[model samples]
Target: MKPKASPKTDQSTVRQRIVDMAARLFHQQGYNQTGINQLIEEAGVAKASLYQHFKTKDDVLQAYLAQVSQDWFRQVERAIAPLDTPKEKVLALFDLLKSFLESVDFRGCNFQNALVELPPAELNTRQLIRGHKTKMSQVITDLLADADPDLAAQISLLFEGALITSQLYHSVEPVNAARRIVERLL
Candidate 1:
């Protein structure tokens, strides 16, 4: 006879589905506006199932932040991997960012948008955003160490400026401009 599936296995699968759906919704619709009911409906999970995964809506938001953080970092690592030199690796990040900017579905950077939209009460989400940004900056600093140690700070600043400008201008030029600056710095 086939072994029976445990409730824990079903519960874990439902929880992951919820988190994945929540991440998609939060990215598309902002956190403050998305409701738990809508999330369950989208995830195709019951309220009890959601609660089995997350105690509160805040817990789901925390999970979303953590998920996005990991996803973004993995993308960054993959984007930077093709190039050999540290400078190339660092500049490749801007290339990765440009691809995002040019994406038709791009609304903006979910992390920065979350920082502005989520309430001060959402400390876990805020911390996750902060941690991701710090790690990104550290990666830049590390890559720039061999080339122009002094340029690491500028690179991070330029990266952030480009991110904001790309969203603000709704164009890919800011990424190009940042790339040009990075090229000059190298």
Candidate 2:
């Protein structure tokens, strides 16, 4: 017979499930358009359970972004893991980005979509988006140091442009365009 699990493990599992569901819904639909009922239904959790985990939908949205940020960072690290040089690592970033675009459920960058929907009054949501940008920019800055320090800033901007443009246009060409530009510049 198995030992009884701790309450903490159960709570964390539920919290993670909620985040997963919200991330998917928030990506497929805009943040404002996704209702709590949908999240609860998709997550297969009771309304009270969700409320116990988060006081409001805004809180869940923030958690979803935070989860995405962490998962993205891990993916970045994994993408660059096999590459030995910083330049290879820089190129690897584009490859990793391409993989995301090709994913079956790819919508857009959730953080970008959320930022567009989050108004001035949604300070917490805005801060979460800004934080993700800063972190991703820092990753670019580190990877591009071997190519050119200043180029990191440009590359970071280009990365964002690619993400937003590809998302809006529903074309992988924008990402390819950015990658070509990066290759030519570096």
Cα miss at 147, model 1 (Å)? 4.5
Please give the RMSD to the true structure for each candidate, in Å.
2.0, 1.6
lDDT of 2 by residue, 93-166 (tens): 88788789778244778788888887789898898889999989999887766566789999898888988788
> Which number leads on lDDT?
2
- For candidate 1, lDDT tens digit of each residue in 111-184? 88778887778778788888888898999998877666668888998998898888888888988998998998
Native RMSD of candidate 2 (Å): 1.6
lDDT (Cα) of model 2: 0.86
User: TM-scores of the models, in the given order?
Assistant: 0.90, 0.92
